[model samples]
Target: MGNLSVGKADSIPTRPKRPLKPILSDAKNVPRRRIGKSHKGRIALLHAIAHIELNAIDLAWDLIARFSNPSLPNDFYSDWLEVAVDEARHFTLVSKRLSELNTAYGDFAAHDGLWEAAIDTKDNLVSRLAIIPLVMEARGLDVTPGMISKFRAVKDYRSADILDIIYSEEIKHVKVGYSWFMFACASMGLEPKNTWQECLKKFYKGNLKPPFNIKARNLADLPQSWYI
Candidate 1:
């Protein structure tokens, strides 16, 4: 019976061999600050965000498939699956906006940094949750408002509207990650703040850029004391 659970190991879900593309490249080479107050620059910005959302879809599913844990309650699966759905919707909405601009996802080069975070933390569910949703998704919370403002400044209400929706929903996604990470820490009798800090030091190889959205992060239960 290969179908049987072997002493509590959950069946591992298969990983996608490759991400849906715009030809992955180094983050350094990715065109930076393309969100200038111009039509072409706006298109570049949307393409970049669409790329992140597409990778987000895969990353959510990858977490479910790569880190299946039978002992963990069903809520964990439910959380990530729900996140996957949200990310899918986000990708669809942004891609539609790209279509409106007579453009699509592959029109520009994108950094592999997001998926790289997923790959690096694939081995540990805790690190994966910490790095992906908490660290990565949390970064979205930090930067999105500026994007929304940028779009509004250029009178691109349609794109701004879409980003508004994503900004709201992403708060919940980050909350889910924070909740799960805290749950894991409690299970192992570790302090949440200390353990999270340690994980960031060990697993996240990059520094968190400042000018953070402290208020939004506070809403998600990630206090400044932990990061600062």
Candidate 2:
């Protein structure tokens, strides 16, 4: 007497991943000068922002479609849904900025590097959290402030504005990762700090660089002990 919805087995949804070569080709062909020099080097800046946004879109979708474990609570799906929405919004912000620069997304050569990590972390929930949000996306917190200051120096308000939204939302995204990661850690009786240390030593792409946004890490609900 097994439960199968009283009839049919559960089904997983299918969503093909985004194409890469096509996106990169469009990016390469677009002329860089169409963006006004009046914008003070903002054209290049806007293009870079657009590229990150595009990659974020793919990251969000991949998480939802691949991690469809019915045993996880509905809150799990809801959490990811929020992330997908924010990623899409961030994409729009940068895309609009590019338009104001007289350019568009896909106007420069970019790679699918963001999705590569998603695929690598796909097989396990802990690996997914430890890699995607904590290691990769959280790097944005450490790096974006400097980028924002540069844009501000160039008087590119739009670019900085878009970055502000991303920085704020990224805190929440990282928090989501931390929540689930702790849940998984507890479920498996793995000490959180030791597990993260082992994961970093094993799967981390590079050194866990410093200049971290300590405040944001706390807000993201990372173990307080790590911050101290």
Highest TM-score among the candidates is held by which one? 1
Model 2, 1-228: lDDT tens digits are: 123222222443333455443254443454353233375346766676666676676666666666666666666667877888898899888888778777777656664555566666667778877877877877777788877777677677778778888999999998988888898888888888877767767776678678787777878877656533
- Pairing residues by index, what is the TM-score of model 1? 0.90
lDDT of 1 at 62: 79
Query: What lDDT is obtained when candidate 2 is compared to the true structure?
Result: 0.70
Cα-based lDDT for every prediction: 0.83, 0.70
Predicted model with the maximum lDDT? 1
Q: Which residue pairs come into collision in candidate 2?
A: 27-106, 27-107, 27-108
Least accurate stretch of 10 residues (summed lDDT) in model 1? 1-10
lDDT of 1: 0.83
- Candidate 2, superposed: residue stretches over 4 Å from native: 1-16, 19-41, 224-228
| Model 2 per-residue lDDT at 20 | 47
